[model samples]
Target chain A: MHIPDGYLGPTTCGFFYAVMLPIWAVASKIVKKTLKAKQVPMLAIGAAFSFVIMMFNVPIIGGSTGHAVGGVLVAILLGPWAACIAITVALVIQALLFGDGGITAFGANCFNLAFILPFVGYYIYQALTYRAPAISNRRVLAAGIAGYVGINIAALFTGVEFGLQPLLHHTAAGQALYCPYGLNVSVPAMAGEHLLIFGWVEAIVTALVIKFLQKQDTNGFPPKTCGNDTVGLNAETTNGRSL
Target chain B: MSFFKDSVFSDENASKNGFLQSLDPRIKTITFLLFLVQILLTRNIFILLCLYAVSVLLACFSKIRLGFFLKRTWVFIPLFSLFIAIPAIFSIFTPGEPLTTVKIAGLTLIITRPGLSGAALFIARVVTSVSFVVLLNITTKHFELLKVLRIFKIPQIFVMTLGMCYRYIFLFIGIIENTHLAVKSRVGIKIRPKKGQRIVASNITSLWQRSYQLNEDVYQAMLSRGYNGEPLVLNNFKAGWQDWLWLLCALTIFITIR
Candidate 1:
């Protein structure tokens, strides 16, 4: 979900930027140490894929169409750190190139979509599929659950942020400075939508992609070490040295 | 998707000879960013409306369609802020002088004067801020905007990543469209949901493999040109007096509003 401008006050936006800057710094460092020349294009393509995936429209239960935010799917295919960078890039493009998201609220959007969504999704996927056969249906099930839980948690965080705005910043005459809805209204609106509708979309997308990945290349998900053969699919080509 | 085509339309506008298109990208970016911040700083409906009027004037000078701009900006305001601001319009959220009262069933809904103004101000701010962003994007080329970002000292790796990502997105878009068309052809009239999902999944897998192969070929090409991590581009940054004048005008407007 893209949080537009004027929804969050300057204080809240500044705080998120403070938190996100360090995380982005660490992400770049990790990405530099772990990735190499050949993988650079792969990372770029992954970022592009994350950006384009949102354009896919799927028919929901009500004959209405909606798209999934493929944050967790990227994390499952690549690592969580790379997913953070990819999603942050996608969010930036959306803000600058299109008017889809706000410029000041970019940090807050990344905090939800980049950090929380993918990290939670990746960990849950890892935890459930641990010691299980890589090609089994159980891994796909775990991915689905991870997708469900990950988006729900991120949605919860967004709801809390929206709810906190009115409480923290308001006029002396009891007028809200930023977001008008308090926790009472904001929490239910955001969390309910994600829990019932968006979460399932995410879960279904993640599981389908993971299943396809498993069938195509069984060794794609559990990427570990930094060499030509261990990064991801077609490992033989990723021979660029990573320091 | 119409959303994809929207960018194509904006790109066409970016190349047009117009007031905003002629300005330096760095100047346009900074001025728009300042305008966005000023828009966010106020909760006054009048001032917000004034800012929106100025943006509309600028859009006119930029030669973009005003109806399309208004349609894009207004459609989102109702969908997003309307729901959030609905509770604010009632006395339950922010109590004030009751403008009107209606009784439905057992409950009374009191529309408050201050609550109405508060919701109006919030929606106004959102509208004004988004308009500035829309104006900037529809006017400036994407690469020019990225180069302006580089001037701001954003990390090289991040900028590089974005550049590469921007190039590859078009390729992936084609692949996705082709795959969908192929699936539609094979499945005939009515499509099965399960089979559609499988095709989408498989397309993603093949896309990944193709990206990896493309990466190898691209990397080798770069190496042949003696490429390292840092790609050196010829920097020909020259800011004309018009750029400074635009910045001064933007600041004057901000100060007058403040």
Candidate 2:
């Protein structure tokens, strides 16, 4: 899901950056107002956790191993707004320090993974688990479904972004200067792999994690009520220093 | 593990007494961004080649091993760019004047000239952009790069949070490595997929619990040390005449190419 530099046209890159700027600003404001002084360490630790989550490779079929992005899981634990900041921080480190993604396409990557994935996944999980018991199996199932749907949606958006490049930035001779594949090709190629393989990986990981947390910390199982309240913030405020 | 350590934690190259290391990091970062913009805008292969060569030369000047740098940048080229470019070169993607025709099992395939040129241009853009990005990363310390974010008017707290994230990532990496080793020792390498997923989920929960605890402790420590939401940093970034000259030269080159 990490788009490298030179894959998207300058105009496309600029467009995403413009779109993400306000989203990032609002997320920052919400986190800071809610977490206060605890925001710094909480967000930093969350981002670090997000970064390391990608390193754990789970067994797949035929001896293959795949890693989960863990975006939805983080959103389930923290609020979607906080997850947005955490994932964005991790992406910045990846792009600037490790070159895993592109500097120019950083905004685009963040829009997909940080904003779209977490917000969509959290809302889906919230809607499914509305008024359910804290430690019920229904919540776990909701998490699994949310993870599946969220990542697939993000993948579809990525495919559309790639598919639009040729239509938006081709030369006069009809030769694509950036990504050559049209929507017909890029969409299926991106969405197909996630739909078949990665979506399951994300779902299982998310469900299992929720199960484990339920067993370990039953009181903290459903951290926030399904409402306008930010995820994890109410719990943190009640505990008075526990992020 | 070693790759993670080397890529994220290693700063030997950044600390070296090299040309790039002597310049202010903020200046280096801005100039690199300009170079990237130029790389994205230009369509000429010669201009792309020149930018790539400049990146290579800069890497050499920064005391980075040419072999290591080349391997780092080129490895990504095929993985990310070449596969797409290869498909674009066939007549199926970019249909135009035929350059070479291949017949396979009663099917005729044509490689068009326009297709080849488009693919070449795409590859060139990828190479040049990747080279500059790698060069900037390898030559700049990670914290300095994080600090550079402040120039964009990013909040000081956010920058500090990013710096802390960089600091703790290695700690979590160590924890992950130890956990992986323990799992390998106990279960061997051939666990069932379901078991592996369970183990990963357990580990993730454990890590989260640890991080949550650490967050409280660190916050208390900070409060004790007069950290009032705004973290302070040592501002040692002084851009001298040489830095300005380098900036001027970069801008001039970009303008000339344009």
Question: Which stretches in model 2 have alpha-carbon errors above 4 Å?
Answer: A218-243, B103-107
The lDDT per prediction is 0.79, 0.83
Pairs that collide, model 2:
none
CA error at residue A222 for candidate 1, angstroms: 6.8
* Model 2 vs. true fold: TM: 0.95
Index of the highest-TM-score prediction: 2
Residue lDDT tens for model 1, B1-258: 556656533488888898999998888899998899898787677888999999999988988888987876677644677776877889998787888987868899998887887788888888888888878888888877767778877766688888888888778888888877887787777545555555556676677667756877888887898878666655666779999999999999889888
TM agreement with the true structure for every prediction:
0.91, 0.95
Candidate 1 ranges beyond 4 A from true positions: A218-243, B77-79, B102-108, B188-196
Tens digits of per-residue lDDT for model 1 on A1-243? 889988888888889999999999988887877677666766787788899878777556755556788898888766788889989998988887766777888889999999999899988877887666656798789889999999999999999999998788877777777888889988998999999888988888889877776666633333432233323322111223210
